[model samples]
Target: MDVAVEVEDLWFTYPGSTEPTLRGINLRIERGSFTIIAGPSGCGKTTLCRCFNGLIPHFYGGTLRGRVLVNGIDVASRSTHELAREVGMVFQEPEDQLICLSVEREIAFGPENLGLPTEEVKSRVEEALKALRIEHLRDKAPFELSGGEQQKVAIAAALALKPSVLVLDEPTSNLDPVSALELTKALIELNEEGLTVILVEHRLDLVARYADQVVLMDRGAVLVQGDPREALSSEEALRLGVAVPKPIRLFKQLLVHGVKLARPPLTSEELAEGLVEFLGRHRG
Candidate 1:
């Protein structure tokens, strides 16, 4: 299978914590697919994403067991710098990652560090800027950009590495609705262009429609993993406080009233179509 990332029987614990934060995680992310890792707070979502890029045992100094492979290479055997060639990571807070004075410099940092020729670095910086639609913010200082803009800059910085996989952790937590939607559109555009996207987020409403799969976690273990319709529609997911999308919830209610949709809808548009079809057939 054309897998981008693979985790096997994974377990991990922090340096001082008495308990493991991730437990027996086994997952496979296919290349060029958009996947969402979601659950309630403290469900090990961040910890699991960390494993993909060697942050767990390497940077975090935690006890890690089992195996994590990115692009068929053992993450544990490779340094984080080496893993960066295949996986690009963006944290929850953009401020935590932004260190350059200007947005242009921030995006160029990764390629420049790789010791690429100056012209190559410049070319990558320009491409990254264009990809995220942040070309206008290039010359502006990182501090001057809004929260959404700063987040885009951070993503652009990661993209400059030309990684095959992009991992984002709660990237929309600090943005307003409009900004969040704008960011979501940009990400979808990138995913359509063949970059594998693995996102850790709670806002299912914004991303579920585009996700090829959803993995729901609970208390350091996977609660459900499958199609968005199947995963989000599970009673267990709602009970575990996974933010099942509004459309799924509405369809579930209709199901309770003896109305079954041929296919559960994940987005508002799909839900509307289902509703219209039901109304058309049952108009007494």
Candidate 2:
């Protein structure tokens, strides 16, 4: 698999701040992978996500020691505009990016700013809307859409820029349960279509089922990162206050009671299947 993002010995301190937010961080995100980043608040999750898109040293003046690479290009040296082509960052609040009047215009806004030809901009807008399945909402005003639709438009706008990697920081925090689930399904489809996705979310139950890799962070460093079942179910991650998915947690609790399963499950459906198989083996 191609490497999408690489970080080496990264450390950074914001302007007018004495302490660093990230300390000696190292990570590698493979292309077309879906990665979930989890940890308690203020554990440098946001700061690290910023590095992926050159927001660390480019937009925010900070003392950065180390290197961040996106698609094999050094992030520290690239301008934010340059990085935007390769990494699309969607913040916690989707409203922060919905500045345009209509969904199509919103998607067109980024390419237009990049000075692309009018035809190219229109083409990108059309592709983004269709790719996101938001074509029905194209001509509608963004403010009038539902929360889920609004977030979809925001993601479509980011996709219009043709980024290879999409970094979302707590994207579903503000949405209702149904909206959050809808957004999660959309992200999974996007990742399946080969867009590398890095999500920093607290709602494990919502996205854990779709994760290809799980990363746990704490106190300005990555505690552990690996296969979702292994990393999310470990005792170490739970000790650090990282919230594992409920179904995965149940598997862990079962293991403590001398009930051994062949493998941990990442979703409710998997957990149910595992339990049935286990019970069949130990039939009373």
State model 1's lDDT.
0.92
Estimate every model's Cα lDDT from 0 to 1.
Answer: 0.92, 0.90
Residue pairs with backbone overlap in model 1 = none
Measured by TM-score, how close is model 2 to the native structure? 0.95
Error of 2 at 171 (Å): 0.7
lDDT of 2 by residue, 61-100 (tens): 8899999999999998889998999999888877777998
Please list the residue runs of candidate 1 whose C-alpha ends up more than 4 Å from where it truly belongs after superposition: 279-284
lDDT string, candidate 1, 1-284, tens digits: 69999999999999999999999989989999999999888889998988999987899998999999999999999999989989999988989899999999999888988999999999999999999988899899999999999999988999999999999999999999999999989999999999999999888998999999999998898878889999999988889888888899999999989988777898888988998898888899
lDDT winner: 1
Task: Give each model's clash number.
Answer: 0, 0
TM-score of each: 0.97, 0.95
